[model samples]
Structure formats: structure tokens, C-alpha cells
Target: MSDKASLAVLLCNLGTPEEPTPAGVRQFLKPFLSDPRVVEVPRPIWMLILHAFILPFRPKPVAEGYKGIWKEYGGSPLRKITQSQVEKLQQQMSENSVLVDYAFTYGTPGLVEQITHYRDKAERVLILPLYPQYSCSTTAAIYDQIGKYNLGQRDVADVYVIKDYYRQSLYRKALAESVDAFWQKHGRGDHLLMSYHGVPQAYADKGDPYYQQCLDTSTNLAADLALAEGEHTVSFQSRLGKAPWLQPYTDVTVRELAAKGVKTLDVICPSFSVDCLETLEEITEENGEYFTEAGGKTLRLIPCLNDSASHIDMMAAIIAPFVDVQATGQK
Candidate 1:
């Protein structure tokens, strides 16, 4: 590996608890929930609520939930998978002038530290947040931290961010292929459910494009599968707080579909680039219970496109435009 590379690619993802324990979950959640982009309430009030209300009580159950889904070899599934992605991407991008690394939004190998490491070593950095849809809460937080890092640095590497790639042809095709492959193994479900992580409805009203982008991904995927209106549905999941979130909530929709006598339901969370606690436990374990209790036979949770060949190819294609600038000596 070169000590100094012309380009660095940082694959970013929403982080996980270092350990599937109460203390670990709290440590990860504190910074994650405290971010203004995430919670969106006034500082003082939110701080009081966070410390006095949420933190003290939230960690115990969240930790337990994490333990339920912790990867077999140990450690958070998100961390293990993201590290695998870094290795695979590095191997694929094998250009002598490029280095590949990864960082978490809230935990180990943080964004600021990673960005600073590359600033002195590379001419340019590409920050890929790994969220198919763009959200002020997720993608903007990366931009926010990078902007802050640049504030203290005298020399900064040119940064390129992939804001949203849900619309890209490769992305849509990869998702469609993944879904079809799953069906081929288990046979097709009676209905398909595309469940994306939810953002607060207020954010959507205020011009966050997250919700709309999720819709576009679902719409395109449904078209790719060539399914009719009654054959598939779209819903949002993993919402927090009592406040309203994107409509047709996943849990509610799953229960309703089961109660209405739809036996086999296939669920795919497209917003997630890799399987994490939310998809593994919340959707698969928790919501699977919801479907079964409400009379559904089976709830098949389609896996995320984590570090797969097609996914890697899509990422390489997405990063090619930046590499082109490097090849052209266009700083």
C-alpha cells in the first residue's frame, strides 16, 4: 500500500454499538440521537429530554434487542459487514494511487478522524455514505462533519460526496436482481413489501428529499419486478418518538396485511445498504412476530446487498466519475 495515494474512498454507514450491551448501546446512541440533524428539536429542550428521559431508559432494551441479533462470530453486524466492504472495495479498486477505508457515523473510526487521515495523504477524497436515499439526517450529517473538519485544517483534500444513488440504473438493477434471486430460492411470496427506514414527517414537509427518494426507489423496483398495484406495497419502518412519521407504517401495514388473510409476505428494506440491527431484529424478529400473530404464515425478510459482487460493481461505477477527474489531472 502507498503511504500517499492520489485518491481515498471512504465508505460510510450508520454505526452500531461496539458491544451488544447497555453501556455500548448508550455510548453509540448518545452521539447519534444528540445530532440536531437526527432529532430536530431545540437544543436546550432536546438535551433535557435526552438526558432525563430517553437515555436512562432506552439503553437497556435497545441493548437487549442488539444482543438478539448480534452476528455469530461476535461484534455488531454492521461493523463486521462494513469492514468487509472496505476490504472488497479496496481489492476491486486496486489502482496503486487509490486507498479504501470506512468509518461509522457515531462510533469507532469516526468521520472527522478518517477525513483528517486522508487530507495530508490524498489529493481528493470521495465520501460515500452508503444510504441509497439522501436524507438531511444521514447524508447531511456527513457533510456537516466534513465541513467542520475543514474549518481547522489549513490544507484540505478536495471532497466529492455521492448524495443519492437510488436512481442510478445499476442500483435499481442490483436491487431487482437481489429480490429475484431470493424468490428463486424460496419461491415467490404472495405479496411484496418494500420497507424503508422512516424520517419524521415534518422533515419531509420542510423539504428533505428522503421520503420522495425512497418512493422513487420502491416505484422503480416494483416496475423492474413487473408487479401490479395489488401485488406489492411500500411502507416506512424504525420510526422513533411519538411524533408522526412517513405514512403506512411498516408494522401496522404488516399486521393489517396478515389480518386481511395475506399469508406469505416478502419484505425488503432498500434504504439499508447492509443488514443491521433494525432490519435483522426489528423487521425480521419483531415484525415477523407481528405478521405471525396477526395470522400470516411466513414473513420472508430479503437481505440487504451487502458487499456483494453486483453491489460492488454498482459502487465502482458510481465512483468512476471521480476517478476520471483523477486520470485527467483535474484537481
Candidate 2:
């Protein structure tokens, strides 16, 4: 293949701001919130509310949260860990493997930019969105971007999208392993909370499938961990606009657990492949406070499987078949 990658694997994740500032958050959030797949609100009305309320006010606090979690060297934890994932995956795949790269759905090295870059360089491109559970607000947004890009190109590279892979045994195993490792280091908590990012209930009512998928992921992980129903709970986090997101909200659920006398709680975000502002600042600091204030002794946030060996193994396992197909000159 003339030392060029005939097959390209693009790891797509929910994005982060280029800088941990309100202006940076504002720049990243505009396009992200504008997407109809994400907000599910009429553009004219949503735009008014978004600009008048969300953009003007939300960014400052959001940026401060980002700054709290931001690395002095790497800026955003999400972006930094995603970069590590791609680099390590490429190494694991070895020198002659497909070109392994990463892009953000909302920030620099955007969908269209990476799509066009790979299209011009490789014959086949595989988009592996890091979202384990598919949501129209998340995974489908990537598909929407790809569809838009292809509309302008007559001869686009053959593209294959892995919409969702939460069902893969490896993914479940990785979650189990991470939890086990965490518990080994820090004593097990009274309860384990599997928290996934929230989407509007309207989206679920419209058959988004995200709510159910989150439950399924939690179920499988619980099975892997051999936990009884009472040992763990599933909740949703990072809700925006508060028009009734997925029920049993994480914050509320955490407080309720604390109030119920469950001390030393452990929380994990299966929906997040990398640690971002949501997982780092919101889940840890913000929710931790709620837990403590509500009477819980400890709230430990188990880290995501970002660039972990098992996570890379899962990525390689998921992409192996596609690479084999590319090698045989088959789509």
C-alpha cells in the first residue's frame, strides 16, 4: 500500500473545549448545542433560549468546571486521554496496521476535517464512536455529520460506522476489571452506582433507546461483577436545560443513597469512554459534595477506561474484522 494506510480507524469522542475558558467553552458548545439530534428543540426557539440563557450564562460556570479538571499540560482530560487511546491503539496494532487517529465531535480536528483527511488518504475509513450506548443525541450525531460530509462528495471513501458496541463482552469485561482494580486499591463501597450521561426524556419517548441501552450496559456489568440488584444502581448525569432528563437523576440518586445510610459510595460512568468535565468535575467534585452533605462518608469516582490496556484491546477486537475485510479488498 506504498507505506500509506489503506484502512483508517478514527476514534470519535464527545468533544472538549480547546481552552478551559468561557470563550472556549462557548465556541465548542455552540455547534454542539445547535445540533438538532442533540437538543431536540426547535432551532428558532432553542437558538433564542440557547443564546439568551445557555451561551451567555452557562459557559462561565462550565468553563470553571473544565478548568478544575483540566491538566496543566494537556488542557482537557477528555482530549488528552483520547489522544493516548489512539496512540496506544496504534502501537498495539503495530507499524503496518491501519492509521489510528482520533477526533472530537465538537472541537478541533472535527468530524468533517478528519473525515476529509482520511478520505483523501485511505481507501476505507472506519468510524468508531467511543459512545458505548447509542443515543441520537450522541452516537447518531456522528452519523449525521458523516452524512452531511458525504453529501458534498461524489466519490467519498468507503466508510463503516460502529454505531454502538456496549454489548461487546470485552466492553463489559473492561468495566468489571476497572471496578475490580479500583476496589483492590480502595476498599469496596456500600454501593456501586453506574451513571450514564442523560438525554432529554422526550428523546427517549421518541424511541431514542439511550435510556434502555444504559440500563442494559449496567445490567451486563452487574452480571460480570456478580452483583445483586441491591448492590448497585443505575442513574443518569450531566443533564442540561432540566426539561426532565432520564429519571433517577445521578445527583438526586446519590443524595438519596446517602440519606438512606449508604456510606462510602463508589460511582462509575460507563457511558464515558474518557474522563471529561462531566465525569471529572461534575461527577467527582459536585456529586461528591452532594453525597457528603447528604450524609455519605465517602464518594469515590472510579476512573474511565481511558487508554487503558483493556480498553485498547477492546478497540482492537472491535476493529479487527474490519481490518481483515480491508486487507482482502472487500468492503
Candidate 3:
């Protein structure tokens, strides 16, 4: 599609490094951990741990985890999958004279670079976060970065933000369809697990609303799937620091379920639009091993909605109210 001079659309997702190597991961981690929205500790203290300890020692293991999920295609599944989503959105939403592209808030193809690219073309811009549920650590941080860059640019396009869609009906339907499709293929498991990334408990206590929204998402999905209370469950994963975060840790929960004689499990990560380290490494490779070793017979991972038609539709709906388009999709 040709770049137009009046409108630009940018899709933003948490990024990954170029590859699954230590150097690649280290590069990715630097900006990610440096974000104040993410770390939240005093800069002096966090920097010390980040440089002296975490950066020095953590890269190898994290790299190894990335290696487990690395595709033969070279780049990270996170970036590749997210790029697929962006391309589809661009194709579907081509009618508004908008040039659609995506950028990472961290790592290469960064936000500033994407904005500069778009600024050269479009007079108006929309920043859409891929996260369905907003956390200060995720969505708000993207807003902050964009705000900082737009500080003194008179030539910059007018910008609009698409907020969270945790309660959107189309989103819930798409999620339910994914689970049902997996069940049809893989056979019904003893339970369906909805695992989301964890945030610090303090964030919720301070009114972040991320945790509550996660619960509501789980409840809505379960009802749509006609799941009994004990037949479905929700948990959290990906706690980065020592701070107390959301409860029912995913790994521990999987182990405990196996211990209770529940075998044959299927897990879906609704929090992630595209599978990444947390979903691929933590849930599929790591927790799958953990669950099986803990006595569960089998564990299957239902893939994320990356580039899926339903997912694209839901994302288009989220931004429809902001744009002047009569209908989305190509003419």
C-alpha cells in the first residue's frame, strides 16, 4: 500500500530482541527493565541490580528459554507473530487513507523511529496498544513514551489512543472460539486454564484495575464456553521481581492441579495477543514439563490469536469508534 499524507496508524506491542541469543536478549531487556512503569523501584537501586546482577547472570538462562521457542525462521516468535497481526490490520483497514505500521516500545524499530517515519507522511496518527487489558506497566507506559516524544513537535500529527477492550463482546467471542476449536482438535481436557501475565499486587491496591479486569475476563469467557465452576480456572504468570504480585502463580497452579489427579489440561493465554517468552517458554515449554513431571498425563497449549481473523476483527472494532470510517475492511 502507498503511504498517504493525511493519516497514520501505529500498532504497538511489547517487543523482543532480534534473536534468541544472550546479546539479543540483553539488548531487549535494557529498555524494558529501564521503564519506570515496569520496574517502579528507585532508579539508583534498580540500576544496580539490573546491571550488576540481573544483566550479568540472567541473560544466558533467558536466552536458553528463548532458544527453546525460536523458530527456524530466525527472528523471535514475538516479533514475527506481532508483525503478522500488523500486516493483516493494514490490509483490512486500508480505506481511511491511513498507512498502518507497528513498532516496539522497546528494542529495535522503536516508537520514536516509527513516529518519525509516519510523521513524514501522515497528518494524523493513532496509537493502539496490543494489550487487551491495560496496566500502568504496559499500556500507560506506551502513552508516556509517545507523550514525551510529542513534546515540542509542531509538525506532529494529532494523536488518539485506543484504550483497553477487556469487556468487548467480540473479544470474548473470539477467545471462546479459540478454546472450543482447540477442544475439537485435541479432545476435551479435564479443565481449561486461562493464564494471564501477573502484575504487582501494589498496582491493584493503588487502583490499577488490571487484576480485577483479568478476573472479569475469565468469568466472561467461562460463561460463554458453558464451563462449570470447577471445570475452568484462571491464574497469573511472569512476575519479574521479589515484590508480591498477583496470586495463583501459573506454574504452581499447574503442579497443584496435577497433584489433585486432574490430568489432560489445555491452557490458553488470553492476556497475550501473540505468544512470546511468557506463553511459549513459561507456559508451553516450562510449565508443560512441570505439569507432566508433577503427574499430569498431558498438557496442550492453545496458540494465541496472532493474525487470526477474529483477533483482527476485535482490534478493528476497538479502534472503530475513534476513526471516521463507515465500516472497516477493504473496499
Candidate 4:
């Protein structure tokens, strides 16, 4: 693989609607929800539920939620931020014998297309799924796609996939710095809420490490920020269906904290690499209302790291080991 002249790095993330409309939402949701890694239910029954019950009604309301955060640039916040991340990473590595690009796990610029684009130009490809904490539903689904793509090819590039980086020192430092910077500008709140996106409890019971990784990330960040025992809490958000999910659910916890006289809360979603409907609509808008309605003065959302200079530097560091700079004659 080192014999090839160039290297291609592919950054991937969960997708968003192409546009903030029902049809767009449906297009994104269909491929996303249909994945067994995501849904996990028996397919025959799940398909009926998805087609008859879900698709008919879910798209419009979801589209409306997306519209609340759609950018003037004509896409969801996740798409815009991810594109910026790719562009910055490319510029950051411009002098190296490497090319950087990004794609979605389920939407436009699909994984297969991006992988194919690099097949001829580069001898080696590194895939980095942008989930800090790995879960079967998210990270494993990416592997499934790559596996499917590899099945059709006689010749494939040398591929390296980063499974997770939840515990990397640089990543944790970047997260802590982002939070500290937020506090420096806005001041600290009564308590910090580190809310991660939830998965069904059964997934953890079956040995998914996502729950533990989220806890580890929160623990590391809290220690970095020097928070006392009572100063921070961990919860899970964006649960679906009747099945039990990792709990101390965010909405319930927010209401309870406000009722208990905890005022001026600080909330951050550690699970999201970029702000999307979950953070923008669900956390900032919906759950913010829940807190204030329950007597809290404010629920301040600390932004994701996104494409900040620190974040790009951290990304470059994480991918450095997989890149053969000596082989490519990079710096």
C-alpha cells in the first residue's frame, strides 16, 4: 500500500435530511432506520411497523423539527458542520501526500461512493467514524457498509477503521477545553448535565460498550474540569419506543433537577460530534422548555467541538499513527 502515491482519509458521520422537508426526512430515515444494527427488531414485523405506522406519520413532524435548525446554507446543522470539518482537515493536511473527504453513513455522498472515489488514486484508505463513543447501532453499521462494499471488489485499498476514540487524551482535552471556554464566557451553572444519546438497555446488557464509554468520557471530562461530586450529573437522551433505555433520562432528569431547586443548569451532549436535531431541537428547544417550565431559570447548552481549530488538531493527532508520513514524504 505504501507503494501508492497518495493516502485517502474518509470521515463519516450519521446522516441528516437533504432538505428540511417531509420527503427529505423520509429519504434519510428509511435507510437509517432500516439497518438491523439500529432497529434490532425482527425485520418482517419491523418493516410493517416502519411502513404502515412510522413512515406515514413520522416524517412531517421530524421535518418540522429539522426546519428549526436548518442553516441558511440550505442543509441541516450536522451537514454544514461536517462539511466544514472535512474542509478544515483537508487544508490542515494540504502539504501532506494525503486527501481528506467526508461522507454520511446513510445519506448523500454515501460511504460506498466515497470509498470508490479513492480506490484508484490512493493505495491506502483510513475510515474514521466521527462517533466518539462506539455503539453497535452506529459504529458497527459503518463496518457493515464497508464490508458490503468490499464484497464486490477484486482489488481493494488497504483500509484502517478507527473504532472509537472516547478515551484518547487529546480528544478528552479538547472536550474539556470547549466546556471550560463556554464557562469562561457565560459563567458556570448550578450543575453540569452531560447527556449522551441513549440506546436500548438490552444492547448494553448484551455487552455493548457504549454505556460504559459514555460514563468514562463524562468521568474524564468532569475530572478535567475539577468538578466536585455534587457538581455534575450524567443522563441519556433521545430515546424511542416503549423499550427501556439507559436511564436517568434527560427530560425526566431535567424536570426533577429544576423541581429540586437546582437553577441555571448547564447541559452538553457529549455523544454528538456535531449539533443536529437532537441537540438543537430536542435539547435546546424542547428540554430547555421542560426545565424552565419546572422552575429552572435557564438551561444553557454548551456547544459541540465541531470544526474548531482545537478539534481539527485533535483529529489530525488521532489519525497521525495510521498515516505513513515517511512513506508519503509528508513533513
Candidate 5:
């Protein structure tokens, strides 16, 4: 490829273990949890606790959880799905003279390696973190990694990062359409729960826009689907530690809904661009049981966009403007 054939888009996501084993889970978690962006606690204390307490006991159970959701293809669902997203995006943008690839914020095919590989080859590189909402923990961590990598480089390519697209029209439409399709197939449920991955309240209070962004996406999605006030609800999930996170917490809200006599529920995670452990296991498996135990009949999970054609179209549209700006610069 000529130097001009050097436009590359690096699609990024939080990673998963290479294998569903304790050792593999530990390796993935150590670096991931250690990131100051992820855990705001002071490093020295956090490290001691992590190494002594968390790593020893946490990995085995987490690995078991991973085992439950591990794809038959022999890796975490996140990895396989992300790889598929990259491949589909490549095909979708094939005629545009751009190269598309993906990397993880943690684990294999890391950010630095992927960035460096394309650095010399691509004159203009777009770093699109798969997170639709900007959060210090997610999108900012991608920025941090790219910033760190550039520090060691003598020559850096022009880089563009997509911070968030929470309210993007095409994206919201894609999400709404996904939900509509799900309902059409299974029939509409009594309630639609929009669950987002939660961050600590401290982080939101300090100025992370993630909480509000998630709310915005939920509202717009509801509007797109013409959902009435009582038809849907928004909550946060996947919170860890004792620290308070953005609420109403998903599990709590789910139980409350069930107790309130809502028999059927359809849940979706709008914040997640793809389905992973949180959706596959936590929401579907664990929370499904919670709903049933609480007197609700069914808890249906609408899968994330993943490599679906609509999702690919949305991604292509999202990246088009950035690509155009770079192409203009080349002239």
C-alpha cells in the first residue's frame, strides 16, 4: 500500500482473558484493575490489597464466571465479538480505501502494539473506543494509553479519537430498531429496563459525564421507540466494591419491578456496544433468576448491536466525518 493508502481506524474495547482460567483471568485483571483510571483508590494501598486479597480469591470465581460464558471458539465472548465487529467494519468500509482493526485496553492485541503497527503505515489514524458514552474509566483510559504510546515515539501520526456518540442519531436509531425487532419476535414485555455499566458516584461527582450520557441515550432511545413514561426505566449495573455507584442499581430495580407485579421484562444495555459477561451472564443468567425469584415470569435480554449490519452502518456513519476531515488535510 502506498503512503496515501494509509488511513486506518482502530476500534477499541475493554478486553477479556485469553482463556477462561484462573491464571488467565488474573493476568487480565492485574493490569486492568491496576489502572488508576479504573480504580481511583491510592495506588500503593490498592496494589497491596489487589495482590494480597483480590488476586488470590477473586480470579477463581471470576474465572468460573468466564467459563460459563466462554465461547466455544475458545476465548471470551468479548474478544470474539469484537473481532467480528472489526472484520465487519472492514468489509463495510472496504471501498473507502481505509484499513480497520481492533485492540483491547487490556489483554492481548494491546493498544500500544496495534497503534505502533499502524503508526508508520497509516498517515491518519482514528482511535474509536467502542464505548458510546465518555467516562474517565473507559474512554479516558483509551486516551491515556494512546498518550503514553506517543510519548515514546519519535514520529507520531495524526490521530483522532471519538470521545462519545451517546446521542448520535444513527446510533440511537440502531438501538431502538434492535429493541423493536426483539419485541416483534417475542412480543413486547411489560417493562423495558435500560441498564448501563455503573461507575462510582465519586467519579460522576468529580465530572465524568457517563451517568448523564447514559441517561441521554436511554431517553432518546425511548423516544425513538415511542415508549411512554411507565413503559421503560433506566438503571446502572456491574458495580463493584462497596462504594456507591450511579443508581437505581439494576438488580435492586429489577427486584422492585417484580415485586410491584410487573410479570414480564425486557432489558437492554445501551451503554455496551457489544454483549459480554455483564450482559450474557450477569443480566441474563443471574438477574433472570433474580426476577423469577422475585415473582416475575420472564426477563428477556436484548443483545447488544455487535457486528449487526445496522450497527456497522452506524459505526461507518460515525467515522465518516473524521475520515473526510483527514482526507481534506491530505490535499
Candidate 6:
């Protein structure tokens, strides 16, 4: 391997617990909820609340939710989906002689492993958050981890951060294609609800653009699909605590639609690149039941972007513009 070899691309994501147990959820949620960026509460006070109240009480229920999404792969859906993504990305980049790898902000395949792998080998490194949109809690947390890893490197390689590609054309096209494919397989529903993970209103008010970006993605996707006013809806989900979050809430909207005589729904989470508890448990199992119970005849979940062929193409397109030179007959 030459020291002057082309770029090494690493895609990152928010991770999942190692298992579907209380201890597992505790392990994952502790760091995730502890982050000031994610929670934004005072350390002493928040720690007391987290350790004393949240961790002790919330773990069992959260673990149960994890159980709902646990796959036969011996890990949560997040891990499986992300692993598939890394593999597909590697296949795609191999064609261009661009090395592709991935890691999680939390859990195994950690930043340490990813950094060591690339920094020790590659000449130039590109860190791309697997997120489509930027959020202080999500994307910024990944940035912090990257910074921490960089500080510990013996030989700091040329590192470039590919911030957010929420509006990238290829990305939008992939998403539209995924949704269309899903609809084709399952048949189009009366309404297409685009749901995204919700952050607190305080974060958005304080300048987090996550909410706006979600709206932008939803609008663009709707336009691309040529969905009419009543054809699709957008809502936020997975809210925590009493703090106000982006609304209208997905559950509330689903029930409302049911009451209004909407019989079928196709739900998709554009914000999530992988299938996890949020998508599998909350949206599919719980919310699907909720919608059906509320008089909806059917509630079909269009799966996340994941590592589908179209998604891999989108990933390649996103990295193509950033690579210095295209490789020839590489893979």
C-alpha cells in the first residue's frame, strides 16, 4: 500500500446497545443521554436525574423496546443495519479504489478502532456522518468523537469532515426510489407519513437546524414523489421528556388521520439511515398497532434507507465529488 494512495472514507452513525437487556440499554443510553450536547442540562443536576432516576427506572422498559427490535444476528437492528451499510459502502468504494469503513459514536466498531485503522494506513481520510441532516445532538456528537480520536493519533493524517448531505441530489433520488419501490411492493397507501426522530424544541430554538432540515427533506421527497396535499404527511417521533419537541407528533397524527377516515398509511423515517429501535419497535410494532387500533385498516412502514443498492449508489455519489481523483479499473 503506497503512502500516497487515494482517500479513505469513513461513514459514522449514532449506535445501538450491544444487547436487548436492561444492562445493555443502560450502557448505551448512559453515554448518549449524558452528553451535554444531547441533553443540555447542568452536569451535576442531570447526572443525579440520570443515574438516580432515569437509568434505574428507564432501563427495563427501554430494554424491552430493544427486545422488540432485536434481530437473530445477536445484536440490535441498528448494529445489523449499520454493518450492512459499511459492507455495501466498501463494495462501492472498491470500484474507485477508495477505502470505505464505518464506526459508531457509541458501541463496538468504536471511533478508536476506525481511527486506528485509517490513520495508520491512509494518506487522506474523510469522515462522513451517515446522517442525512445535521443535529447538535447527533452530528455534533460525532464531530466531538472525531476530534477526540484525532487528538490521540501519533501521526495525524489529513482529515476532512463531510458535514451534511441532506439535500444532495443523488441522496434525494435514492430516497424517492426507495419509497417508490416500497409502495410498489406493498401498494400505495392513502397517506405517506414521513417521520423523523425528534429533538427538543429548545435545541431548535437555540439554533439546531435539525427540524428545518427534516422538513426540507420531507418537502423535497414529497415533491419528487408528486404527492398531493392529502397524499402525505410529516411528523416527528421518539421524543423524550416533557420538553417541547418538533410537532405534530407522529402518533397523534396517525390517530387523527384514523379518526378522519384515513384507512391506510405508509410511514418512512427519512432521518434514519438504519433500522433501529426507533424504526423497528416504536414505528413498526408499537405505532403500527396504535394506528390499526385507531381504526386504520393498515399501517405499512417503508423501511429506512439502510444498505440497499440504491442507498449504496447514493453513498458513492456523495463521496465522488469529494475524492481527489477517480481510480481506474480499481475493483
lDDT of 4 by residue, 21-78 (tens): 9999999989898999998899999999999999889999999998878844366788
| Candidate 6: clashing pairs of residues | none
Model 1 CA lDDT for position 213: 94
Tens-digit lDDT track of model 3 for 1-331: 4345456778889888787889988988988998899988899999999999988888889999888778543668887888888889878877666577888899778987888778777766788888889899999988898788888677554777777888899999999999888889878999888999999888888899899889999999989999899997799998877888898889899999999988998899988988888887788888999999999988888989888999999878876666644323333
lDDT string, candidate 5, 1-331, tens digits: 2556457898899998888899998999999999999999998999999999999999998887889888553667787888899999999877675889998999889988888887666777888889999999999998998888778778765788999988788888889899989989999999999999999999999999998899888889988999899899999999988999999999999999999999999999988988888999899988999999999999999999998898999899988876645444454
Query: Model 6: which ten-residue window has the lowest total lDDT?
Result: 322-331
Best candidate per TM-score, number?
A: 4
Q: What would the per-residue lDDT of candidate 1 be over residues 1-331, giving only the tens digit for each residue?
A: 4356678899999788888888998999999999999999999999999999889999999998888778453777888888888888888888546788998888989988888888667778899989999999999999998888778778755888999899999999999999999999999999999999999999999999998898889889999999899999999999999999998999999999999889999999999999988898999899999999999999999999998888998988888777745544457
- Name the TM-score of candidate 1: 0.96
Worst 10 residues of 5 by lDDT: 322-331
lDDT: worst 10-residue window of model 1: 322-331
Worst 10 residues of 3 by lDDT: 322-331
Question: Which digits, one per residue and each the tens of the lDDT, describe model 6 over residues 1-331?
Answer: 3655477888788877877899988998898899888999889999999999999989999888877667444666776777788788887666565778777887777866787777656667878888899999888987787677768767665778777888998889989999989878878888889999999999999899998999999989999999888788889998988878889999899998898888988899999888778887899888888898999988888888888888888888878866766444323
The residue pairs found clashing in candidate 2 are none
Q: Where does candidate 2 stray beyond 4 Å?
A: 1-3, 71-74, 325-331
Instruction: Please give the lDDT score for candidate 5.
Output: 0.88
Candidate 1 Cα errors over 4 Å, as ranges: 1-3, 71-73, 324-331
lDDT by residue for model 2 over 10-128, one digit each (tens)?
99987888898999999999999998888878789999999899999989988888887775435778877888999999998764448889888988899779988887677789999
After the best TM-score superposition of candidate 6, give how far the Cα of residue 222 lies from its true spot, in angstroms: 0.9
Model 3 lDDT, residue 64, Cα: 90
110 Cα displacement, candidate 3 (Å):
0.8
Candidate 3, residue 180: Cα displacement in angstroms equals 0.8
TM-score for each of the candidates: 0.96, 0.96, 0.94, 0.97, 0.96, 0.93
Clash totals for all candidate models:
0, 0, 0, 0, 0, 0
